[model samples]
Target: MSILSLENVKYSFENTNILNGIDLKISKGDCVSIIGTSGSGKSTLLKLCSDLISPTSGSISFYEKDYNSYEPINLRKQISYCVQIPYLFGDTVYQNLSYPFKIRKQEVNKDKIIKFMKKLNLDESYLEKGINSLSGGEKQRVALIRNLLYKPEILLLDEVTSGLDSQNAKIVQDLIKDLNEDGVTVMWITHSLEQSESIFNKRIQIEQGKIVKEEILK
Candidate 1:
């Protein structure tokens, strides 16, 4: 089943075009890896799909309906984006985890939160710890957990491990792999060739605002 489809999608900033005449389809539960050099428009495509930015031309549809048909807030809940840098707003981990819940007007599921932290090898005590006090890896994991806890139908990852140390990068990498295996549809913008070949079944290569090549890994 196709969950996302972009038809003749184009985006531009000022007079510079970022994406042009792009057409693609992402299936349900697909793990897609988007690869390209910096400024090749890979991230722009992800943002377009996530509705962070709209296309200058063409259309995007989700779940067989126009993406614009869904409310922005609710659409984000179903299709969440995790940028390269971790953005944690709260003073404490507890507050961060509660953010998703608060937005949905629902109570935080403490049991699920604890389980999620444990999966990331985080100590329970860290829940009360300040976000500013957490290490890079810890903050990344918390940011990831917050989005996952939002229960998004699709996940858009934008080079999330690029800024982390080897060990920290592995943690985020493994978490994403695990999530994909567990049936989440993931579109990851990554620079790692090994990761593209190993984790993703489909790969999209972009160049100068166009999808120049596409391959299905065996």
Candidate 2:
């Protein structure tokens, strides 16, 4: 069964349409890349999936259920979102990572968090470091790992590698590929064609808020 589906989804701001008649189906474990130029509504589409905003018209369903039927918080927890620019809280790295767990009443898995940090080339000592002390790349990695630690069914990434250096970007790309291989569905939006081709199994091109082409890379 498809994990997520959008049926003739449309979004508009004022009178200008941002997304028009977008129909998509993402099955479990599918690594789909959304490629388009700036202002093409790629990020908006991701936001809509996460319930950050509602579409102006049309319907979205998740796991064969209408999106509106689920509680907003529950819906968001099942579909994690990582933005282009990382948003770190005014707290320590450990606190930031553990916040989600606290809200969900899940126990903090310190060992697992440390292991994930090490896998991403982040030092264990960073757990106590203030969020503002880290560089842009560091923040992005931390944010990415935080979402991954929860093992959401679907990850919605919007230009997640954009702010990182080439090495860090490659690390993130590889991680996404690994996640997809592990049966996690990924809907990734990126402006980098090269990265899109390398990391995604399927490519969906969007132009002016509409899907222009859908290609299977592998």
Candidate 3:
């Protein structure tokens, strides 16, 4: 079944259309990449799916239910959104990882957190280090782990690996591949055609807010 469906979606700001009649479907366990030049409504499309902004016209559905039917917070929890530059909070790495659970009134699982960190090539000792002391790559890894700790049904990534070095970028890419293999639907926006070809099975190209092509790659 399709996890996400966008039917004739349209968006605009002050009457200037940004997205025009976009129709797309993304299935569970699929790694789909949306590629376009900057200002081509790539991020806007992600925001629309996450219900961060309402579409000007048309419908968006998740798991066959209209997006408007779900509670905002509930929808956000089930569909985690990761941005290009991650934002980290709290004094230490451990505190940042535990923040999501803490806000949800749940106990933090240290072992699980550590395991996720290891998957991203982060050592357990880094947990006690202050967030301010880490580099951009470290912050991004920690932010990503925090998002995945609860295992959201779908992850919306917006140029998530753009800020990483080659080594760290490989780690993030591998983690994304692992998540898709484990049945998490991923809708990612990227400018790198090479990365798109390597990491995603489906590609949707957008130009001037319209879908110009949708290709399924082996």
Best by TM-score: 2
TM-score of each prediction: 0.93, 0.96, 0.94
On residues 14-133, what C-alpha lDDT tens digit does candidate 2 reach at each position? 999999999999888889999998998899999999999999999999998999999999898889999989988868999988877789798998888998898788988999999999
Winner on TM-score between 2 and 3 is 2
lDDT of 1: 0.87
Summarize candidate 1's per-residue lDDT along 75-138 as a digit string, tens digits. 8888989887888885899999987888778887898899989877787898999989988778
lDDT of 3 by residue, 128-171 (tens): 99999998878888889989998889999998888788888888
TM-score of 3: 0.94
Candidate 2 regions exceeding 4 Å error are none
| Superposition TM-score, candidate 1 onto the true structure | 0.93
Superposed Cα deviation of residue 19, candidate 1 (Å)? 0.7
Cα RMSD, each candidate:
1.5, 1.1, 1.4
Comparing 1 and 3 on TM-score, the stronger one: 3
Model 3: C-alpha RMSD to truth? Answer: 1.4
